[model samples]
Target: MPVGLMLVLAVTLVFLDLPLVVIVLFSFNSSSSLSEFEGFSTRWYRQAAENPDILAALGLSLTVAAAATVIAVVLGCLLSYAFVHGRRRVTRPVEAVAMSTLVTPELATAVGLMTLFTTAQLALSTLTLIIGHATFVLVYVTVLVGNRLRTLDPRLEEAAADLGAGRLRTFATVILPQLRSAIAGAAALSFVLSFGDFVTSVFLSGTEIAPLPVRIYGMLRFGLSPEINAIGTAMIVLTVLLGVTGLWLQRSRRSTTTSNPL
Candidate 1:
């Protein structure tokens, strides 16, 4: 790489990751101060684990993320298959509309969801947060799985059809197996995105319940505590793991495609 490019990359990385690095370091701080780290300790992590409110918020976040991932994967895969294999003229416009969520500001989506819930007289809770999360993640699943589907040859399905297999059976036995990695990748992405999301969770959640991110934000208002750092560190580790897993699944899908070449 050019020297200028390398310098730019280094500066960008530092700018992005400095906060995370500080959070990880401060998670072990013996003092309550955000700056001037004292002796290292895992005390905050223990405190976080024992804290009921934090635990409740974490549970809510996980539940919302899991529920969203499941719903998004199912709907996204079906939509992706239809758009990829079925009529383009009809599905194309709809596909664009569905993915418009990606470009739409999260604040806009959050406000819209809040408005919709109010209009419907549905109370804001974990269920509403799950719905909000799913709306955004559905686009990720659809884009990833649809791209993977496009790479598949129609002859594979045709061959199965020629063998007198029912459409559903062929899909279940053949196409679904091929789609396993893509689905897994999509699920990982969906979970990470939903878990890390704050705006939608904040808007959709009732005052009675807060997701982890929102909880952490509330914690920051009073003062800096190592407990917040501990929670942030845990979340960073989790997000990294999920992101790495997604990348691995995508790579595995490519390998499978090259080796099988059907």
Candidate 2:
């Protein structure tokens, strides 16, 4: 926490982010040369805008991410709730199993999922992509929900019950509201992970259902393109904006809760 060490850490962080900065800068370059630094222009952006394939991939990625996030939110919430409220012996093992997904390598998981789908004669379509994305996203959702539930006061639910509210009503009116931030954060993280996912998507996505990350990977095989840089730069900006908004909302909620303590 010393000032000099903090400065060094800040500089190191900036160095780590330099690649992204380079991508954003190269995105606006007009020159066809991918190797050399070029002056700023929106030519690559224009090309990206006109490329129907890129647009289609982006649309597909969004759709898959949205669908997967929705599934994860519901399933994660249910799993977390059961684990948190159920008998200790049962819930402990169940929670551990649910979180074990995070311990496995993503490549191994994708390969396993692909093998299973192939064995079942399932088509590698958008549906498969959503399923693949959801598989990993579910763990994130569970982690978020479980962490929030751990911090929540069980007395709130007890109080609601003491007032004659049924378990369902107490959960809907009391528990769910307190979990809003975690839910939103988890959903956002899932969406980003799904959207940015390349390896799983590449294996599960069919010829017709290519997502943006897969498309970007394909483009890379042909060598780096300025348009790819442009697309990546835009994605980086959008991601940063979303992250800032989520953090701001989290802080604002905490401040409100503290100021209006009951």
Candidate 3:
């Protein structure tokens, strides 16, 4: 890379990541001061761990993210398959709608969803939150897996069928294997998006259950606390881990495919 380009890239990264670095560092501060860090201590993490409301919100967030990821991955993969294999006349319009969700502002989607739920007499709850998240996340999974599917060799499926494999068998043995990395990436992305969602969760969350992001926002109403920083650091760590795992999976799949070439 050119020195100038490398400098620009380094500056951009620092600009983006400096705040997160500060948050992680301050989370361990012995005092609650945000401007200055005294010394490293796990006091905030301990407090956050002990807080009942934080714990409840964390658990609810995990449950909703997990459920939504599952729903999105399954439906998204099926939709991707249909887009690639189904008739163009029917799939084109559906694909357009799916893609539109990505460009649509999330706040608008949340409002539309809230209105729909109200019209249908559905109450805002964990179930509604999961549905809201899954509805948007499905588009991400579909795009990722569908792009992967489009790049695959169609003759593999034909050969499987020629060898007497049925549709399900061909998909399971041939297509699904090739799609494992894409699916894993999509699942991780979906989980992260759902877990970190604020706009949708804020609108759809019920009285009984609120996700961690919502809880964190509620905490802001009182005042800033070191414990919130600890929670934020934890979330950042999880998101980074998921992203790294997805990249590793994709690289491993590529290596395997290159070496085997079967």
Candidate 4:
């Protein structure tokens, strides 16, 4: 590597990961001081597990992510299929709307959604958070699946129709199978984005419902501690696991597609 490029890479790595390394290290700290790590223990994790507020926040986050991921997957896939199969004039406007959401800032989306709901006299709650996350995450799904659909050969659908297969049957057996990897990737990416989202969650959530990221941000105002470190470490591990699982699913699906005979 070039000397300057190597220096830039090192700086980027440290800037991004050095604090994470510190948090992971201090999560096991026996000392109370954030700067000093006297010894290692899992006491903080246990304490976090026992904290009611943390537990509630974690539960809310999981539920919201689950609901959002499923809804986004369904709606996004439909949007993808429509973009690929529908008339260009009709689909272009829909695509524009979707892309606008994807490209727009998260703070803007959050604020806009919050204001809309308030104007409509709707209270922000768990349901609103789920809808907010679904709205955000589905953009990723639509883009991913729409690209996959564009790459797909239209002849395959025609061939299935030539065999006298109905539209729904051909879609279920032919089209859906081809998009498995894309769908799986969309689901995983959606989950991670929704679960880790703080800006949208904070803006849409009421005092009664707090997702894990919102709770963590609230905790930061008071101070930092091993319990917070433990929570951060846990979230990082979880996000990694979700990404790995998605990759594995996509890989397996690709293998199956390549190995199967027509």
What is the clash tally of candidate 2? 0
Point to the candidate with the largest lDDT. Answer: 3
Q: What are the per-residue Cα lDDT tens digits for candidate 3 across 67-169?
A: 9999999999999999999999999999998899989999999999999999999999988999999997999999999998998988899999999999999
lDDT of 2 by residue, 1-262 (tens): 8999999999999999989988988898879777777687999999999999999999999999999999999999988889889898989987887788899889999999999999999989988999999997999999888887887878888899899999789878999988898888888888888888988998899677789988888899989989999999988886787677667767876787789654
Model 1 TM-score relative to the real fold: 0.96
| Regions more than 4 Å wrong, model 3 | none
* Candidate with better lDDT, 2 vs 3: 3
Model 2 segments more than 4 A misplaced: 1-4
In terms of TM-score, how similar is model 3 to the real structure?
0.97
**Tens digits of lDDT, candidate 1, 126-220:** 88998999997999999999888888888989999999999689878878888899999999999999999988988999898999999999998
- In model 3, what are the clashing residue pairs, if there are any? none
Listed in order, each prediction's TM-score against the native is: 0.96, 0.94, 0.97, 0.94
Whole-model lDDT per candidate: 0.91, 0.88, 0.94, 0.92
Q: Local error of candidate 2 at 6, Å?
A: 3.9
Model 3 lDDT, residue 96, Cα: 92
List ranges where model 4 is wrong by over 4 Å. 252-262
Better of 3 and 4 by lDDT: 3
